[model samples]
Target: MKRTLTILSLTTSFALALGACNQESPKQQQEVSAPAQTVEKPESAEVVQDTIKKSIPSEATGRIGDASIKITYHSPGVRERVVWGGLVPYDQVWVTGAHKATTVEFDRDLIIAGKSVGPGKYALFTIPGRDEWTVILNKNWDQHLADEYDQKEDILRTKVKPYSLEHPQERLKYRVEDGGEAEAGIRISWEKIGIRLPVAGK
Candidate 1:
């Protein structure tokens, strides 16, 4: 009876070891399977505000004797801002308009305020003052504002008096008027003031 009890106890211990080997642990089973892949998403882009300069193109054509004269420029609005002695300053070179420089083209040789200017395209620049203003005709017709303007390139410089306007003009304007037989006027009007430059064909 003692020998039979020993054989049965040994068999029970052998069966428990076999069962534990057959069943895998939870951690071991996870390692045997394939790993999951992770994907990253793209981020959204930010929006920015656009800052654009808004200006309008203006053109004026008139006759100086037999010669045809043309003036082209960009017009800027007052927008309730102070024009002379404030936004434009007292005595500094101005572009005379917004954006690009104002251009005047003459088909023939002309005399501006007793100064002779050849027949070509010229950029119009100005120095605004309370009483008088200096107008310039530069050889560099294609330029941005007055940043690259050189006083040495000026073909003609004339001084004229500023005229007070009865009715205010909201936007800047240029007009080529026929004064008489040999005389013509180039008028620049903006806000509450105006200036006229005399030109004669030669």
Candidate 2:
């Protein structure tokens, strides 16, 4: 009778241990399977291209004397259409940016061609001519709508030298360089047009 009771107890303990192991096995399997299902997909090449396409026009800054000027231009696309008397006509105003109007700023009042121009933000425009071109600075700030341009609103107008280009400019660009005293020239160039606006810092 004693032997039979011991054998029965051992059998019950083994069955309970087996049941516990079976219950824990399912939880272990669930933990291992979850990471496989939650794996992330890699980004496609098309998605990366779209991100670059949306960010076209970019900006760069330059310092000339006490003045800090921001140069903004259009990044590639449809820029080849920029031509004199076709897209940008002779003796007409053009916003120096492709999408929005480009701007130049001065910390204090500056002079251009012996004309007193106040310190503030201005929209840069140019009137292309054969020998000389006119650089215009308007008090307007915003650019994309194209309606802010007003001829009578011009703050300063000055004649700049126009030079013939040896090679075609693929994109329009502008830069501010250091000039002696408080002065600098704002250069505008694209394909055939090269003009400069001399700003006296002193």
Candidate 3:
């Protein structure tokens, strides 16, 4: 009788332990499966290519003297288009960017062409020519393209010589060359052409 009682107690304990293990096994399996479901899918190649084909909203900035010079615009690519004389005409006012007029902002007063320009945002317009390009800073920085361009609203205009690039630039880019604390340059480059606008911080 004693031996039977002991055997029955051992059997009961073994069954309870087995039940507890079974319950915990399913929970462990669920935890393992959850991570698989949460695995993220990689972006498709077509989606990546689409983004590259579109015009990129771009910005470039620099520090000269006490101000932060900022350039904001959409960068368009040169997909084998004749940029200088075809897509972008020669001698007409261009927005200097694809969608909207490019904006140039100086957080502090700066001098361009020996004239003091108050610290503010201005629409950057350009007249592209074979030999010379006219760079204009207009008061209205809110217009699209050159549609609402009023030369009467121009704050500053300067003619700069255009030079040929040894290597073609695939995308339109603006660069602020930091000459020093007193003098600097703003350079525009696209489709094998380059223009430099001299600026002074003194």
C-alpha TM-scores of all predictions:
0.71, 0.62, 0.73
lDDT of 2: 0.69
Candidate 2 lDDT score at position 43: 38
Ranking by TM-score: 3, 1, 2
Model 3 per-residue lDDT at 148? 94
Global fold similarity of model 3 (TM-score): 0.73
- Give the Cα error of residue 173 in candidate 2, in Å: 0.5
Candidate 1: regions farther than 4 A off? 1-53
Q: Relative to the true structure, how large is the alpha-carbon lDDT of every model?
A: 0.84, 0.69, 0.88
Ranking by lDDT: 3, 1, 2
User: What is the Cα-based lDDT of residue 141 in candidate 2?
Assistant: 60
lDDT of 3 by residue, 37-100 (tens): 6664454223433236667899999977777899999988888778888989998999988888
Worst 10 residues of 3 by lDDT: 42-51
Question: Which should have the higher TM-score, number 1 or number 2?
Answer: 1
Q: Highest TM-score among the candidates is held by which one?
A: 3
Which is superior by TM-score, 1 or 3?
A: 3
TM-score of 1: 0.71
